[model samples]
Structure formats: structure tokens, C-alpha cells
Target: MPEAIHTLRVALPPEAVWDFVKDMNKWAPMLTGYQKHTIVTETKSLWTLKGDVGILSRTVELEVNITEWAGPDRVRFTLTGLNEAVSGEGQFEIRAIAVAGSAAAAAAASAPVAAKAELSWWQKLVERFARWFLGRQGGGQAALPAAPRAAVTAGSELAFTLMMEAGGPTAPLVNAMLEPALIPATEDLAQRIVTHLEKQHGLG
Candidate 1:
């Protein structure tokens, strides 16, 4: 099996990060190659990912399950191909760099980021989908609070990793090819989380 592990540090606190990842739908569409996902239940979801299969673009169906939720720290998941011969395990790990808020009140906050450029079409689509799937309330989505307490601040590290293997004679070639794609996906995951948290906390 080949593994891809990537990490990113964001200004948001662990609590805020945890809040976002715990609800898979909030970030699922942000996934690279993401097409759509349907929650079969709370822990299981059917996902369709669009990516290149050799030289041809293809959509692959995957059945994913959330195996564990170590809140404010990690989420473990396992997935298998529904239409192809592949299987993988992945996890999102979160750790606080500094805890500033009282334990009773959970400590973490982010500074306001400068306004960003207009989003790409897919960005707009994903945002719209997330808002619709999670619902929207005026300028902000009806997900988390508009802003966390200004008095709190906690730095956090968010990481993602996956180990996967393709079955068959071309498995090695496929794995080698996938190596490059995972890095970009991981970066996308990090940026997506950071941007969403900042927006959630009214930081823009």
C-alpha cells in the first residue's frame, strides 16, 4: 500500500477545526475530484469522485465509513471502491498548538483575513452545494456561529493521510500515478477548512 500524509497549520483553534470536520458534509465537496456524496446514514456515505483514469476522465464510486471520531483531535475512516478494485483508509488529525481559552469554554479563535478574489466556478458550486446541503442563513451559512469569542485564540494543526492500494497487474503503475494527486488534494483539504473556519467566525 502507498500512503500520503499531509499537514497544514492554520490560525483557527482545534475546537473550530473539529467542529468543521465532524460534520463530513461541510467539507466533503471541497475534496479534490469530488463530484457528489450522499449520506447513507450518519457514519456511512456514498461518494462519487471524478478524476483521470489513465488518459480518460472517469467517475468512481466509493463507499466510505467513519470509523472513529476522536473529537478535537481526529477522525478515522475507511473506504472501498464500489465499482473498481481499490480500498483505502484515511484519517484527519487535529492538534492544538496553544490553548488560550478556559477549558470550560473551549479556547480558539481566528483573525479576520483580507477579502479574497472571486472564487472559481467549482468553488462557487461547492460553496453553493455546501450551503444548500447544510443550509444558508443570509450572508453566512447556518452552520457554525458567525464568530467565536474574540477573547479566545488557539493555534491548530490539521493533517490528513490515506493508505491505498489498487488490485491487479497495473496496481503499481496506478499507485505511482496517484502519488502526485494526493498532495494537491491534501492541500485543498487544508485550505478549504481554513477558509471555512475564517468565514464562519466572520473573519473576512
Candidate 2:
């Protein structure tokens, strides 16, 4: 099956990023479709998500398992639908860029960063399409505006990306049908999540 991917970089130390990503209890709700989630263990979780697909609105439930948990650098997980028809895996990777050193040194010696996420194939596709459309529109949708990049500090930057794949092969079509409602909804959710995180860390 095709996979959709989204990435976001934040201006935070690797440890800080890892801490936020490692704990699903804190960040899962940041997702646009997020409804509720429960941690089954350090490596397992259950999720409920609500969103629209074309003209159809739905609430989906799924299970997620952490396959890799390399702190301050990367996280990987697989999502399985509990009452839906979706299954997929995704990962978050953080790379640091520095301003004072040579490109090679900066790349090799930048600050540590971390990311965490849980999503299904269908959800990923919808998110990818929304982003593509938003980028083409130049960011003026009232509900879903373009995501703004922020400087972590004087020379560091933070960015966030989200992609969700629908439950089946027809997800792209479904997403397209729901574009009118989804775009604004997505933008609103994205902005809120960013705002919440920044406030949480005193970066807002």
C-alpha cells in the first residue's frame, strides 16, 4: 500500500523533544482527528479519532505499538485498526542544524532532537492531500492557514508536518471529496496544536 508521510522540526533540545514524543499521553491529542487515547504499556496504546471523509464523518479506533524508541533521535510505530479497516506504520526523526560551524560539523554536532506520532495509512493520505492543497493556496484559509516556521532561538528553527492515510485504497478519493471541510478543519487543528505546544514550553 502507498504511504503518506509528514514531518515537523521543533526548536528544542533532543532530550526535550524525546520526552514529549516518548509520552503519547501528552502529545497524541495534538493530532487533528484525535478524540481520546489510552496507554496500554510503555510500548502500546489505544486511540480514538474523529474526522470527516468526503461528506461522511466518522470516529475510528485503533491500536498502536512502539517498534523502536531511540530517545532524542527517532521513534517508530505501527497502527492497527480496532474497529476500522486501516493498518500502517510511521516514524519521527530529528536532525539538528547549527549556524556557527562548517556544514559538516554543524550537521554532525547539532543539538539532539526527538519526535513521536501514531497514525494509520488512510489518515496519512488525507493529511498529505490537505497539506498539498494548502501549500498551493498560499496559506490564507481562515480555519487552516499555512503552518508558520519558528526560530527555536536566534539561529535555530522548528517546523511541524502531519500526514494521515485513510483506512483503504480509496482514501485519496475520499479525502478529495471532503477537501472543502477537511482543509479548514485541518488548519484549525494544526494551528491549535502548535500554539498549545509553544505555550506549554514557554515558546509562544
Best by lDDT: 1
lDDT of 1 by residue, 85-187 (tens): 8788899988875423433222122221111113455776776677677754433323322244534456676777776668889999987766556556666
The local distance difference test score of each candidate is: 0.68, 0.53
For every model shown, the clashing-pair count is 0, 17
State the displacement of the C-alpha of residue 45, model 2, in Å, after optimal TM-score superposition. Answer: 1.1
Report the C-alpha lDDT of model 2 over 1-204, residue by residue, as the tens digit.
333332333334556655666677776776767899988888999989876766677897978888888766677888787886666666665544222223222232222221213355576677567656865674322122112342213122232323345567777775455444433443443345434554566554
- Every model's TM-score: 0.70, 0.57
Reference-based TM-score, model 1: 0.70
Residue 53's lDDT in candidate 2: 62
Model 2 ranges with Cα > 4 A deviation: 99-194
